[model samples]
Target: MAAGEVTLDPEIALFLREMRAEWAQHPPLESLGFPEQRAVCEAVRARWAEGGPRMARTIERVFDPGAGKLHVRVYLPDGAGDPAPALVYLHGGGFTLFSIDTHDRLMREYAAAGGFAVIGVDYPLSPEHKYPVALNRIEALMLWLRTHAAELGVDPARLAIGGDSAGANLSFATALRLRDRGEEGLVSAILSNYGYFSTTVSDEAEARFGGPGSIMDRAEAVSYYANYLTDIERERSDPLACPLLADLAALPPVLLVIPECDLLTEQSLVMDARLRAAGVAAEAIVYPGTTHSFLEAMSLAAVARQGIADGARFVAGCLSR
Candidate 1:
């Protein structure tokens, strides 16, 4: 928790302290099972609803071509006008917990700081829509953004998508999927916060210190991934499901933000390494003195604010390049 020489905000520091208390609070995940895990998630979401600001704007809303509607909360800063560089924003909840409202603060900050229109996709959640469900919905919205850029008042050529944790994993894959499908209008860049790429977790990963960040534990991670898959025990090699596991060739520029204290730090670092080796103009930065959900509490953490600002710049520069 001692992240470099920097001291975190008091609220975030206290929040992390509270979170640490819940680290082993819920027994072994195996004992809880899927149904019980989902119940806990529902209660968590209910509690999150009692927060955030009332002045947030609604810029774009699209009925998803798929099953559910992809309600995009558009965060356009006060001075936003003309065709601005648009960011397709996704929220992290391991495809389970968080909703757009839960991630409102971060989105608002991005729109205000970067002077970009953020299309916050309220994609479907997991253990329900699972696996490709959210990713597919994201792709559909991306295509719509490209085909109707004028309607969105955005330049399709200057588009970027990013998210935290699970959201980041999806955004990274969405970009690769766009390129693979030969879509002429693809996003110029991507950002992944505490990204989870490969499905493979080593034995040591599960044994000591736990693997990946506590936000998504080993058992929950495997179960969530399993739930997201379409088939029965048959895994798909499509990189869109796991961008880090996918070939980095022919992808656009990327910026991966990693938390020094988070367990998933290594996951993002490896993905950055692969993308750089493939010459895809990728960059990885480890933010010290923060927890997994620091990005959400940017109002309390200057480091989190800096991380989001850095990500916005990365996306903007990708389009500019």
Candidate 2:
């Protein structure tokens, strides 16, 4: 289907309209510094994070396992037994913005839906922290969970990792790191939600979804990559930085939640094909009439709830094994 002819789900469109209205109250994002921009974004997203499932138990922890301080929030749903299987979730904001708090309700929803624990990581952002810093810390978090799952009441053997956009990239990259270390068994499943896996945006996607009034344009996407990498020319091809270029063999079962109208949709499609070609069990579900970050509209969009429910089912099935 042509991009221009693709229609957005009515509820998702309303969510976007509300978001745009909230953003319009603030000054132009380009006029502000990174800190100010993030502050504005957090405020705008705060409203959406509210009024979701309440967790049975929530614990916050700060771990300094050598790669700076990593703050993590653990959400345990009602009826989740001791040492419950956990899904380590990462939030998306182009690796430059957003936080675990920004994605709080989404994590809670997963914990409730899957009947497991959810660990939300507040990894360091880009520009100030740069590449490898956030990746190192996230990898460290996984390794730490391996031996200390009891501490968080999580099942060390039945763990999964997932995220949206930049978070999705990190989830896959962390798995790659684990595979290289011969610890691929650490992650039993991968849940990728509209992952941003490549540094380049196709000309067709740019022309279709990158124009004005879009949630994310090609220029904004390029700027995000620039912010995450030290050298875009060199690191853009690094499989760790762009999982689309990574060797997908030996990774665990992967469920990709793709938003059909997103500018980064092509990246997920290409990644899905490469994963299957590499002999990995990978599934991609493209939600029709959706846009980037549409999953955040769970409070208002049924498609968003369906996406979350699909991911929860995938994670639950993988962990039960």
Candidate 3:
């Protein structure tokens, strides 16, 4: 199918329409500074984060994991047992925007749907934190979790790491880091939800999905990469910064939740092929008529719910094995 030709799912389209309307009320993000831009983003996303699956137990903590002080939230669903399999989730904002609070309900939904625990990390954002700052903290957290899983009632052996967009990039990069350290088994699975795996965006993707009124455009994406990296030309090809360039062999199973209309869709598609070629078990489910960040519309979109459920099932299955 031609890019931009496929229609957006009705419910998802409605969600986008409402989001655009909400955003229209705010000043242009570029006109504001980073702090103001984040504030505006939070205000806009606050409504979508409300009223989702409630957890049986939720705990919040702040701790130094050798890199810096980090905040994490743990959600335990009803019926989850001690030493529960946990998915350490990272929120996506191109490494600059969004937070655990903004993605709270999405984390809760995963915990509830999977019947397991979900750990949401409040990793530091970019332009202030830059590359490897958040990655260092997150990797330290995972290593810390390996020894402290019992304290959090999580099974250290069954832990998985996953995220959307930049989060997905971090998750995969963390796995690669662990693999290099010979601790690859620490992550049993990876849930990549419309992951932003590289800095490159094709002309076709730009033409179809990077135009006016799109959820994300080329310039905005470029700005995000610029925010996250100190040197784009040098870091753009770094396997850690762009996991699509990494060796994929011997990694844990990966489930890629791809939205058909997203600019980054091609990255996920290419990664899927590369993973399989490297003998890693990888599954990519392309959601038709969907766009980037569509999973956040779970409150109103069935496709989002299905994507979450599919991810939950994949994680649960991987951990069980």
Candidate 4:
């Protein structure tokens, strides 16, 4: 057993075991072509869509042709008044796979939990769209949100952004870009779930969290980064590509949810420290006995439920201020 490898929660262990069984039968997602990989991802998501809690009063899909036909799903929770607070979300797929449909249930959960209109952005993928392309589209979406707040039932004054994994990376990157453009006030809070902020692995984090059983291993991380940024040397230090290396002053308050047994746990720890050092309010919580992408398994993981609740509280407080 590795030094950092701890016993998984009974349910979590069972969940991993089941996934491992499936992986043994099918080629790993990374080994397949993009279309096949996406199909597999959607298939997995379909199994979990057994009528989960639905609280949104209205859900609508809108298209922005300016962002290359980018699709955004808006979820307005029940009892939400006109001009409700909004959280612009990006779905996680390591910058390659997954879509709004794969993450629909999760976005709905956040909308119901936070009492805010959650907009899920279906941005372009990498190995095709590549670096900076998705960022530009997201920035356009932010601008569109500002201009169409009233029409969309969102409060222009109270806006936030967030996502998980690759989406979280985009969320932070978008906020940084907005700050550089003197539009930082567009967002009041950030919700980052098991995000990847740095391409380089910290030795401390590697020793503490890296292991065979971890959902995202070092090789997989390297592959994802490679696909997103073809020129690692040239793009590695770019703030938009790696927020951990960015200037962290006066940004929005951040709520980070870290999964203890995951390889990317260090990103959240270092991000929290950097934000605090820069006099920014950034709170992070580590869900013990959980692994990367555990939030998607909320129906089976109590820690995930708690993490979502914590996120809801953080967003509510930030928007109310």
Candidate 5:
């Protein structure tokens, strides 16, 4: 398939093929004004407000220790054992949108497929609390998980972390922090999907891969990066601010998923290179014919749904060891 032409996934191939012509009739994001973009995002999320596969056991309103009053949702596989392997998820919305309710389905599916526990943290967004605040919330969640491993029935020792888009960025930064603090065995693997990193976009990447794919636009990346940084100097070196800039050695094995149609594919690929070069065990898979945030459209997009399966497979392999 060509760069923009994606083959549909077997599960939703027919749907995508049929909807292609209809979706082409109108651009999804163009209708939104600056104010409406937030509303549009919320409206779309409300439509899928109840996220995840229907079969998993989900528990909501859990609190984080470090960030008092912070909330998280947990997904436990049906009949999963005590102290099961766990995967903590952070939702991606360019650090602006998406709540636990928005991504419940995807988290549940991951828990069910991997037969592990899934924790979804609803961290604070940027330009309000800004970069480090969100990262701090994530790190606190990790530390809290480690502290309450017994109560939560989580094997923090066999844990994995991951997220989509902005969430994936948090996971990457958290992994780096864990490595820096000599905290190994806290996470066995990480599943990163179209994770955001780097403010330095080449004119070439911007020119070629700039368009709509699934939920977000390729052009929005520049804006997201700008908002993420409160200070330009700090942005370059804040290991917590930009994970791709941090040292990758001593981190747990990672599974990086890069979708061909997303603008962040190049950024993710660059992280993959860094992880490998630093001797971290990492496997990055690029899903052809798909765009970013594919997992959110399990009901609508075929290849997007397949990416979830791919993620589950990666998690299973990472946990097997």
Candidate 6:
């Protein structure tokens, strides 16, 4: 679809309108103070999550003793075999907000649909964890998972990594790091759902998706970046802080699910071009009429459901290949 032709799906638009109305009645999450914001995040998740499906098995709070007791949640789909394919999922919250619990329902959906185990990483957030901290932790987690895959009931060979928003950024960065370490073949695919990849916004993006009617405004974008990378110098130079600037060649096949009405659409487009230019196989699908974080409202959005299904199919295809 043409970028300019993008419009919000009626249902999604109504959802956004209702959300704005509610935020007006209550305080907007972005406008609220930090403590209140955190509390509201928890409340919002509880309200929207209809209790995810029952998995064949679920192990929560699994600790990686070698990495400061790093916690991860493992969700195994029903009828999974002895060495099921797996995906390491990172939760999106601009790198500073939300937790694995908030994203549990979506993870379960992906796990069930993709017929693979989903490992959700509860990495430390920013302002407390800062640049490269999350990246380093992700690398360590990858290593731990590789070493312990047999015990975890997953095949290390069929592993993939992905996330939405900041998590997507980390996914790309982690893949790049692994590539640099000559372990790029470990990743079978990448699932990036409307993820932000740069701290800097392009003029074309700003002209296309930024402004008054945008779901994620420029100010909010700046705030998220600031929270994640408080250090100006590092934000500019650290490849992990902005994977869009990293070497895109030699990475695994990537599936980028782009939302139609998000400022980050252009980021995905740019990355797609770079990946192709660098000889990396990449497929980018734009979900027409959707906005950023639409997957969070899967309970209310048909398009969101389709997007999740598409993601599952893409991952399954990658593993089969």
Residue 321 lDDT in candidate 2: 97
* Best model per lDDT: 2
> Who is ahead in lDDT, 1 or 3?
3
In terms of lDDT, model 4 sits at 0.82
What digit string (tens of lDDT, one per residue) describes model 1 on residues 1-321? 343234545666766665545544555545675557655544444433344333224565667644457887777665556676788888877677566776776777777767777878889876778677788888888887776866766777778889988889888878877888997357877878887676665554444325443444577666667767766245546577767668778877778888765546667878888888888888888876665667765655678778978987877667666
Q: Lowest-scoring 10 consecutive residues by lDDT in candidate 5?
A: 1-10
lDDT of 3 by residue, 257-311 (tens): 9999999999999999999999999999999889999999998999999999999
TM-score of each: 0.82, 0.98, 0.98, 0.93, 0.85, 0.92
- Between prediction 3 and prediction 4, which has the larger lDDT? 3
Candidate 2 off by > 4 Å: 1-3
- For candidate 4, the per-residue lDDT at 77 reads 88
lDDT per residue as tens, model 2, 111-186? 9999989999999998898898999999998998899889999989999999999999999999999999999999
Residue 105 accuracy (lDDT) in model 4? 80
| Local distance difference test, candidate 3 | 0.93
Which residue runs does candidate 1 get wrong by more than 4 Å? 1-12, 19-57, 60-62, 65-68, 203-215, 231-233
- Compared with the true structure, model 5 gives a TM-score of 0.85
Candidate-wise lDDT, in order: 0.70, 0.94, 0.93, 0.82, 0.73, 0.82
Which of 2 and 4 is ahead in TM-score? 2
TM-score of 6: 0.92
lDDT of 5 at 229: 74
List ranges where model 3 is wrong by over 4 Å: 1-3
Q: Which lDDT tens digits does candidate 5 get at residues 176-220? A: 877777776778888998898766656555554555333334457
Assess the local accuracy of residue 213 in candidate 5 as a C-alpha lDDT between 0 and 100. Answer: 38
